[model samples]
Target: MGGSYEDAIALLDTRRRVRRPSGALAKDAARDAGLKPEFRVGGEALRGKPGIVGMSGWMEELGHSPADVAALNIIHVAGTKGKGSTCAYIEALLLAHGAATGWPRSVGMYTSPHLLVPQERVRISGTAIDERGFAKYFFEVWERLFDGDTATESQKGERPRYLQLCVLVALHAFIKEGVGAVVLETHHGGEYDATNFVEKPVVTVVTPLGRDHVKQLGPGMKDIAWHKAGILKSGAVAISSAQEEGLEEVLRARAEERGVFGGDVKVVTGTEEPGVQGVKPDVQMGNCAVAVVAVRAFLERMRGEVLSEESVRRGVEGFKWPGRFQVVERGGGRERWWCDGAHNEMSIGVAGRWFVDGLEEGDRARVLVFSQISDSRDTEAVFRCLAESLKGSGVQLVIFTTYDPDQTFSASMSLDQQVATTTLPSLDVYERVWKELHPNAEVRFELQLAEALNLAKRIGEPGAGVDVLVTGSLHLVAGTLWWLGEGVGGAR
Candidate 1:
């Protein structure tokens, strides 16, 4: 019945000690240890467990002050996609200005489906919290939640332990590190999300909203947009990307209704005078413009503050994020690989357009190795977009692979089934229109990434332009990276 900090550490350590290295074995051990058996956002198991619907009540009970929390000077971002990239840019800008920064992002940034080491979920200044610090803070927070009680009457159906614990731990780490600015990327709808407990933020940024997480949020764009817009507070600036057709109007109306100044809500479409990076890529304009506007708004709010425009520009231009249009060079002058996390239809179309229009004729061969989770909406459309974009680009095979079966939301299916059902049909539709438009192009699909990459390497005619693109899901990119000897940081 003892629930002391020491006891909790010993318990967690014992649980870890007994888990095997293989995923299946570890899952079994977790079930045996009475852990929930279902999956959670960060790739942790939460089978048959209750979830915290909202953190508002909990934050209030803890006597946490929003003003004191705002004193940490944080920017909160929520979106279905681009949240991680945006957060990375903001963090980089703050770091360039010599401010201590803490960023908690989704999908292997802060937490992942599995943790090879626990410290990856909590970090300060790009370094994981040491084991001692992790244990110290984790137990300190856990004891407070349990109130150092022993054998208290067990609540029949209390909040699941993991979600509650993660919120407390994150808050504790942010406070302990004395982070000057913390950038948080939220999961699910913003209003009820764990991070929503914070009081009025300086600025809330929303990236483009699309059809995703339909089961949890809703089926329509308006519903999803409303959920994302939940972060906006009266008088706080709200920034968003230029929407498609009526979407922008919907957002503008919402912000107006909330009494936020009309000028405070900025919608970015494209930028003039393209800036030169080491490489020129498509979507660079949109991404850069969004980052620039958001950063400017935040800085303007702190007018008398010490942030400078030059430093902000430097931070935005110099920020680096892997697996989001990342181009890695191979040894021996082999084909280069472009890795991205364009799992949805819109993103794939954007990437395809970039490759076709940006790359020079003699630069690199474009070969796509794509895979996605089964539960993804309109994946067939995504494949079609990629194919249409690369119609006349001399692009080679479109290799199709299955994402990690363990971490995906959909039921497991064979690689062949995935290609036969989704990728193949999409390719056929793409070909029917493509052949009439351009008869010189060809598209084929393979069931394995390794084989596809090997084929691409062999098909390269020595000096011929050859670039391999691996994308679809973050898991697919992470898996390919692991095979290529790159460290999957969260997976150790």
Candidate 2:
């Protein structure tokens, strides 16, 4: 009562408040005497419940026992990057297997940081759960978690954040739907993430680790590897894509500690062999190799048989995880747009290299639309990566903006886009970086997502190999795709 809403947000944000939302009934929950629970912080808790030591109790408080989750078979995937694609591969493999046997007819896949829509996090039979069903199951879980005797310690003031709530809701949906298999991706590192409480998984996968999530997962790849390794369980097989130099040893040690013997730890090396034409060259074959081996291991362990090479290949080849390096042409527009959610240095570097490769050693009228998450302070590095990618190629235009509405969030777009007035101070920081790197390429700062797309369209020269790239963040890619009218509800 003593402070304004903005003041309250500032105070709670500065406090050691949880990273994600606390699912607490912020208003009714008692904090200290007459003090409110700080609704502003409560809202942020939905986004970042900071440290991750609360999921075990929160699951029980939600009336979901360990056995409840165990009812559905799960393959937990964790890593800094490529986790979503690996999860997609695992899910596709399970779905193909499910169609063949009565064992698992429905597969549910859950991944974090939804590309576009909120429902993208939870998919049933390879499609987003319908809006009605998502809301129904969502509030049902919310009620059971906070209402009556089911109130969690969070209710006393430790509410769950967005990722935890989404994971719980997804688990609820999968169990209720009687899904045969669920592919679960950890929100952050595995050890402290909510999904780590799965108790048991048929198999655990560590996609190639990198330097992202530095604020929470610590700085180096080893520290991040330590956290990602938490998904490994004693009896479950462990799998990993080739990690940078010494990180593989760290993964092996973690797997060994989790009780996976030497033979059980599968390390993949460039599994995407030559002659794979339809796939993007930048797509890591190593991650796919990890996914395939994981699927084979899970099937042999759980069903006592391995899928045929043909079936596994089909599954992996057919898997569609959007917003990686996706190309789209809007309304027969003259320019071809390629989009990748490569926010970190490594990923952006890969995306940039791919862009250069596609150019055939020639320059083009290329446009780069980039935005970074507000919290990550590595935009300078990202700009450098882009510069490295476009080194030989002639770049025409560069745009900087927030994930904010250059395009308004509406029904035509995702209603869940949650419009807010936030400025992109990072653009100013990046502007300096761009001048240092690409002194000639024109850089314009736009506040609206719509304006950015429109500007690219008007100025983009058609025909002679003009390329427009949207990278930096998945949120940016998702918003751009939605603007291009790719939000039609379907399995893809």
Candidate 3:
């Protein structure tokens, strides 16, 4: 007999024979009908568009249900740094309180770059939709938006973009799956970000803003702060980390102008022992405080008002975010490494201070495997801050490494200048460029990451105790972590 519904069911059954498979047949039928499990409403038409202002026009064309759109509970977060960590903490607290959550974060969490797996971007509760299911949703939404003929009003002036379509697919998935909340991390300035299209968020959180993304945002902190503050909605509560003197005022005025109450805007302050692994790092305490305040504000606005001081306390104390001063042991305790995503000068200074205070007297050599992109403003300043912070602290060695293969600009002279500016002799900046640029260089630059890490590990013996901090960019952290046998965790 020709392939019928029963045959499709059998195929699905074979795919899931190991599990208690019962939904196989229905799933297969959905796939056969051009409905993939994952949803990508726009496909490649939406990737890297200039701004979010144009997104509204495209969204209107999709004909998505207004009621479904209204049901979306969004938490929009934007800042120079700490945005990812804050989102992670908030997501974890909500999950603890029994709410289903979805996060749209940077980096390929579900999909690989340059690959055909579009479903990687649309994840339901941290799980990417399967291939068959992804195909089903892709076609189903495609047909609904643009009739099967692919010739209609939808075809006129329609552009193929990835980010725009990804947002649409995520929203559609959230509506279809009935998720209670969605946490969105903006790619750039919040004012024109696609996530801003969602109705005013219930709560908007701003982490510490600093000088970064100069090309898109601006050159200084004030300008960057304004762009980030654009996400604040009138009458919506806003929570922020303690800001610089002038920057705080700017954020406050913006919130006030929008009619967002000044009193409702809470700034995270004070400090408590992080209590993670029984090691109380000072920076962790500050982060914990900020998280606590944000969660309390969120719970206070809940319908039934179920949050309590004790519950909030427990949630904050129990929070653990990897890649933020994370220390992992490899090869059965023979080697140790620290991973942190501190890219900007302020964060780098903070990390340096934490190490200075935490390091024991007469510890083994301290090595830094650092790399950054060309766009990072004040690369020299960041290195100087770190070098100055470690002065007279008995740090044996500082290794400067480059990880980006496509970097057009070099910060080599910047590092050299910092050493002269600070007059610090204990710090040394090593460039991998000579080997990276040479056609016949003995060591491959890409593979040199492993060699650099292994060299650092070999330098210290167990008795002396060395600390290896892998930082600069999230890309570097991701690469190093993968090599060390640790999978990157959820959104943050």
Question: By TM-score, who's the top model here?
Answer: 2
Instruction: Write one digit per residue (lDDT tens) for candidate 2, span 1-492.
Output: 133323322332233333334254344333422233353321222123433446667777766788878777888899987888788877877776766665578889988777755667889878888666766776666556655465756564555555667787788889888888889999877776778878878788888888776665666677778879978898788888888899988888888787873445688776553222345554655556667788778888887976766667667666787787778875464567888888787788888888767663443468888887646436777777777777756667888766652232335445234353567666666777777778888999877767787787766545454578889887788788887777726432
| Alpha carbon lDDT of each predicted model | 0.57, 0.71, 0.55
TM-score of each: 0.71, 0.83, 0.69
**Candidate that scores best on lDDT:** 2
Model 1: per-residue Cα lDDT at residue 53: 38
Per-residue C-alpha lDDT of model 3 across residues 324-431, encoded as one tens digit per residue: 777787656545577777777778777667666656666565666766654436666666666556554455544544453211111121211211111211122323
Candidate 2 residue-wise lDDT at 202: 78
RMSD of each: 9.5, 7.6, 13.5
Model 2 TM-score, all chains together? 0.83
Clash total of candidate 2: 29
The CA root-mean-square deviation of candidate 2, after full C-alpha superposition on the true structure, stands at: 7.6
Candidate 2 Cα deviation (angstroms), residue 340: 0.9
Put down candidate 1 lDDT per residue, 175-198, tens digits, no spaces. 766675566667656754656666
Instruction: Name the candidate, 1 or 3, with the larger lDDT value.
Output: 1
Task: Quote the lDDT for 201 in model 2.
Answer: 83
Q: Which order, best to worst by TM-score? A: 2, 1, 3
